[model samples]
Target: MTKTFETYSNIQSQNIRFRNRFGIEVAGDLYLPVGYETQKNPAIVVSGPFGAVKEQVSGLYAQEFAKNGFVALAFDPSFTGESGGAVRNVAEPVMFTEDYSAAVDYFGTLPYVDRERIGAQAICGLSGMALTAAGADTRIKAVATTSMYDMSKSMYLGYRNGYTDEQRAKLREHVSQQRWVDVDNGASETGHYSSGYHELGFNADGCIVTGESLFPEKLPEDADPVSKAFFDYYCTPRGYHERSINSTAAWTATTPMSFYEFPLCHNIKDISPRPVLFVTGENAHSRYHSEEAYEAANEPKELLIVPNADHVDLYDQKDKIPFDKLVAFFTENLK
Candidate 1:
């Protein structure tokens, strides 16, 4: 069945699978523009918004890129959607970053792709992974991100760097205790730690409780603006997909451990000489991430803010996305 939130008649799409360096099979949808076989094409690897599967916004981006004449591949990350991984619903930083390179590897083998012109585009949380991958993997000639998020920094420092040293210590202790619990239970615990950016899950009894659906059926009266916005997309027919983690479930209880330890996008300067583009909504709560990336990056980087748009707007809002700018960036740099 076609799982993507959007479909295009002008582009050809195929379900494809390839393995990452760890031998886990990653699933993706490859989109090719009309007459793709006639000539070589600059290819792009796309993924993101963290827990979302490829069928959501990533697929939309790929379809649009393909329609605009770039070969685009959007994939489910290592442990989500149709991708293969053990103990599903866990997020590992290193593995996630490697997934970008895996997509590049898949593109390199394609006869219709120009290997030297390959690029990557990530949305939300995966933006950090895209930048990290492009830094070390020179094969990714260019990179771009929309509504960028630095997951590592967020995990370690909390939203807007609100976590105090005491809170950080408490979080570490909680996760460490949870590890022992998992070892004894022979399975990973699952919970809703992401509900409130600052409210990490911890019951009165000190046990993590399973979270309600990530996408609530109805908006809570006191729901934060960000939560409400996310619900409008992930819970509604507009962006909901059965396979999306954000729509149906929660991550493993200790999924934050790796993100806390492994910093990402620290190599932003390494991507110098090779261009990078940071695109974010001017009103997005996550806009700081893109701004920080642009500041840390060396020459040949650009930061673009779409007026009056929020983080979720960039996910599937075609009119809000700067497609022309993205296409021009890749076209100018990938060549």
Candidate 2:
């Protein structure tokens, strides 16, 4: 516990667990504002970057938000990190969407929390989940997302809209067939193409070895920039976590099977009367997602583009992330 506190000396926090709607125990670290629970303060819940655990960028944001006077909670999504669930490291969109609302449920019971003034924030793939939750759950009064990516879009349409209808049809066929093949397999099913990255370690020259070395000494220049950036963060001390699926395991084999059916961007306008702040890097590959979400939303919304930044930059690049904007947005709307 002391060791954990040493990692982030800027704030005070406590480990907590709460039961979700499914009665699963969700683990989190709640950052309390200075002076220790003296007031019923506005609170924020944070999560993100898809398979990332709370110990990484989410915790960074939570601790910073706490320093700025709002109590903040960062939790692992179900089936990931310390959160309780059957299978491990899988992305179930519906259940992941529910995790935010469940965090709200936990906040309501905290003596230091002003439940009426609650907000939520996320980054990358989880950003779309945060927006979807805020749209459906009125309890969330404001939503903020950085470096947003629509996971469903990534699954069905492929990165940057590169996949064709014919390719998608083949993908659907592949997933449907796997469902039958997995009936008796129990988390060990096959036929997934999450290939290319297998092993993770460090070489003699301190170069991070990710997978079977598609390139011997350096990453291929033609590799997807966003993925390369993710590797830079999760493969080094910048934001690595042993429990994070991004750091320790390859993308889930069944990721496409569950994610293709759930499009989180469908009802972006539903959260009106409630405010939203969408933040994305100017150079982010997923910036289009935040742009489309902002356009679809009703009034009382904002799209903040950080100059000279990329998708993963907002994850742990504290200097690059507009935390001031976040503090101001939550303060104004969560009042």
Candidate 3:
């Protein structure tokens, strides 16, 4: 059984499973507010921050939302954690976005949930996928994102759009060649692009695989600030969970292939009638992602930045997360 990373006195949680459109069984923890059985309540489907499982940050958010009188579901996306899918640790953009809608489907069947008032909160990398789902599925009445990271944009343009034309071409060339190699080898290889932050692991047919563990047992003296911040949360008992990909494993080598072609939130304008709330740390490296998304989004949108906080700080830092603002946004819009 997966351990509960965070819990609240006013909330009750139960393990649940539901199938997505593709028939993949998705696992989730359903958190109900103290008086949930008495009447219908607004709901939120929460997940994200890339490789993390539902037991970590998402679960905490779900519990918090439940404590505040909203029925919330924190789920593991397909192929990660307890969710079912072939070839573990693969990151498929289409399926990931579909998971949000699947969560909506589950909530709509619950007598205690107000389907029309349902919303979603996605953290980190899953923010993009959540927004994409909101754009396509009108069921998600309101959407919010914290510490947003557009994986597609990051994969295509590199961190801070640092990749030059030649660099992008070379990376794409390697990825294409790697696909053929994987087909011939009869297995998906694990590797990461040279851009952004990643620890090096074993070599597979000349590909430098991302490390198995996101952080080492002991911190290295020369670890960069970004890696250090992530390490302090995911590697420590404060936020660590064995099933989380961010805590224990790396994504498959070719996972970035589909992300390169598909840009998330390309249809940000489609979610106009539905409100969007973008929250990020003022000092977070990924603050730019929320800013870019906010600029592209139509009216009925908000961008909230917490002072003196970094990217990972928003992951589990209760004091800096501005939960009141999040609750107010959902309450005002989901009504």
Candidate 4:
């Protein structure tokens, strides 16, 4: 028999839409904790893990936070999941930052939410996006990230390792050509870029065989291990959801074209005074991202690691997640 878990409590959830500054309506699920007696409670806006939908990790995080007494929202970024956008699977770095800011706007207007105590959390690639937003807007009282990705750096440097300038230039050219094709054809192709390590039947190797290979110099000492875990997360039912862009074959080719040029941490140091927390697995492939961002950020910043865990492990492994720590972090800071 399969084990069943009650994912949510007496939580009341609603589907709502909020428009960004660009007038794009973004879809989200707002979870109101039970016993809400018209009292103003701290609100948290949660998103990310890159191509993932709200139904996946973000929703889980929202539900958990709601149960813990915060008004939490899990939203789909513009152009992904149930959010509004013309081209599917497209990622705009600037628009993504705006998405978080828009969520703050929505939260601020809610009667039951303590507008001044609003907090934000982002996972995977959106982590950097949240930081960028917090740096610009003081509305976000506190910010936290999990399995974070410095998207701009990742685009240029490849993965946990690093990439060469020549290789990055080549990738930019390829994506640029693909974007032109999309414009000419009036539609972009949908599919995965590679079979990943799991699909290719290499459980241990974790190498992506079907997609464009990484530059030889970008491979890290632990690249194989991290790749294996990522393959398991994106390929297996454990973390896979049909609405997730990662579950699908490919993303809009133009996404990389824009991502390569976006600079996420240009003013990162400005997020100080307000606390910033970076959480990643000790054994995660992407822990270095948190370390780097923590170093670049000023004081009132902290980096927390979940020992013996991988990147995907932080996605939904309830037992391993430090819920109490998170609650305490937000509570103290958002106050």
Candidate 5:
């Protein structure tokens, strides 16, 4: 069970649970305006910076939405956080996409939610997942994304478009071998989260692996921009949550196996007529992703870049989230 996190004073939230299509129970914190008494309210289901639980930035966004007169829900993806999973901290691209539609189903059933006015948003890795979900689920009448990364591209190609075809091939080979090893070891073995930077080592095969750092403890000022921004949020009191994957633990070793041939974002054009908003920091490392998605999407789409900001800045940086624009976009389209 998720303890309800604090948010805006005028926002009220409740911890709730619902079953996904697979009959797995998913946990969420649903937020509503303090005096909300209307029936059939516009709603949006929100999630992710990938590997994140509902307790972090997603909760902040959900509460913000509630304060602006929308029913908002933030949930843990399957196999993570308080959500049900046989093996914890695993990432399933397909199942994650399903979670959005499941959320829409839950919203439609609620008496105070406007079933036809439902929308969805994703932050970070879920950016691409929201695109896929909105394209496939018409119930999602509008779509929004912030500092988005296509999980598939990040998996095979690596961050910032690093990693060549040859490198990706080598990575795939290693992941497959790791998969077999896990199966041989009863498939109950878990892997640690991405070992942090400044830590360096190598495996028996000579492939570089992360190890504890011999350098003095890293300060946010000395770290790279992306790492610094994220660390300040996830590693400090600003945004840290015990259940967050990025904040504390690593994912299962075989989690990467799910993204081998994944190619999402091709169907983004299908979400036309319905308004779409793509928000990214002007300097976000993942900005190209939103640019490509914006070009692929139809006229109803708008891309808004936060000036002087980076990917992680939008995670919880109130000054950078553009709540006015978000409220306007959803209000106009979800009508």
Candidate 6:
């Protein structure tokens, strides 16, 4: 018979604070299982979906991991959520990767954590960040990602539909101008300019309607259905949060500037020997990301498709999350 681990009867949660290498204070929700003991238990660091705060998906993952006998934390990255940074709603590729490394550092110091057994899981854009971390930091023993987004590719080439070279150049020019404006103003600036929607001219009373004009015209045939799934996730209340970057206006115009230049998969082969798990929905709009990353990663890797699931379905859909597999993956590897 399989051993039945007792559910945590009185889990304790608290707002915890830690700092990155850059001295930026990172805030996170720390969950502790009931009857927890300081036996140096294995721990997992969870973050991302990018532009999302710990209060959302990351917190949920942390809580689930804690329930299964692990020390887990979900943190807000610098410049977003409750974390410290001068400009808000900005995304920095380097600093974001540093944030993951910082989490590993914090986990290493905790009295109740088995420092050597630290693992990480990043979702969405943060999955790319996790891959960056796994390659650079040997401290991370095992890594996993769900619904991964190759931010670099998405920034330069658009989504799965891809972008024209002319369109990409125009985007670069737009970001460059925004950088100059911010430098001159000496303060963060915000306002909508020419986004992918404006290029298509599908304005419908201030909202960019996503019908024939937007999706069918610009998106690839294979991506139309997937884009619909992404639309449901971002536009609906199902996973929408006031703090989600997707639910808000485009990030500070200059945010994409750095993303366009940074190639995220440079050292992917370094993660070899250490197992990597890529999880994506079978019908997810972003399944290609996991597939590409899995293909590029070296030996000791896995690609898992949640059957019949869509891209957003893996987010907070308890029935489709494959918790048993996740638990077994981490438990077996962390040992």
Best by TM-score: 1
Worst 10 residues of 6 by lDDT: 208-217
Per-residue CA lDDT of model 3 for 1-335, tens digit only, reads 35536566667899999999999999999999998999989999999879888888999898889888999999999989999986787788999999999999999999999989999999999999999999999999999999999988887787787766766775677667767766777663533322222222224454434444556788899988998998888777877788887777667666777888888898889998899999999999999999999999998999999999999989888999989999998999889
lDDT of each: 0.86, 0.79, 0.85, 0.78, 0.79, 0.75
Tell me how candidate 2 scores on lDDT.
0.79
lDDT of candidate 6 over 1-335, digit per residue (tens):
11011224466677888899999888877878655575878888898886667767777788888988888888888878778876666678888889999998988777888888989988888888889988999989999998899888877776663676766766777667756766677553533322222122123343222211122322345555656665555555555555655555445656677788887867888998899999999888789999999999998999999998887777678889877888888999998
Candidate 1 structure quality by residue, lDDT tens digits, 1-335: 35646577778899999999999999999999998999999999999988899889899999988988899999999978999987677788899999999999999899999999899999999999999998999999999999999998887777787777877787777667767767777563443233212126444765443453555578889989999888888888888888888887877767877877889998989998999999999899999999999999998989999999999999988899999999999889888
For each candidate, C-alpha RMSD in Å? 3.2, 5.9, 3.8, 5.6, 3.7, 6.5
Ten-residue stretch with the least lDDT total in model 2: 193-202
lDDT at 289, model 6: 92
Question: What digit string (tens of lDDT, one per residue) describes model 4 on residues 1-335?
Answer: 11112466488888899999999889998988887657999999999888788878888888888998899999999988889887666678899999999999999888888889999989988999999999999999999999999887786667654565666666666666665665666553543222111111112343213242212223356666756566566656676666777765545545665666778977789988999999999888789999999999998999999998888888888888778889899989978
- Could you tell me the TM-score of candidate 4? 0.87
User: Per-residue lDDT for 1-335 in model 5, tens only?
Assistant: 24334556667888999988998899998999765675668998999988888988788889888988899999999988999977777788888988999999999778889888988989998878889988888889999999988877777766666776767767777776775666666655543332222112245775745332212235645566766777777767777677877777666665666776667776788888788999999999889888888999997999999999899888887888898888898888889
Give the residue spans of candidate 1 off by over 4 A. Answer: 188-212
Stretches of model 3 off by over 4 angstroms after superposition: 1-4, 188-213
Ten residues in sequence with the least summed lDDT for candidate 1? 190-199
Q: What clash count goes with each model?
A: 0, 1, 1, 4, 2, 0
| Collision count of model 1 | 0
Descending-TM-score candidate ranking: 1, 3, 5, 2, 4, 6
User: Distance (Å) between predicted and true CA of 266, model 2?
Assistant: 2.1
Structure candidate 3, residue pairs in collision:
191-253
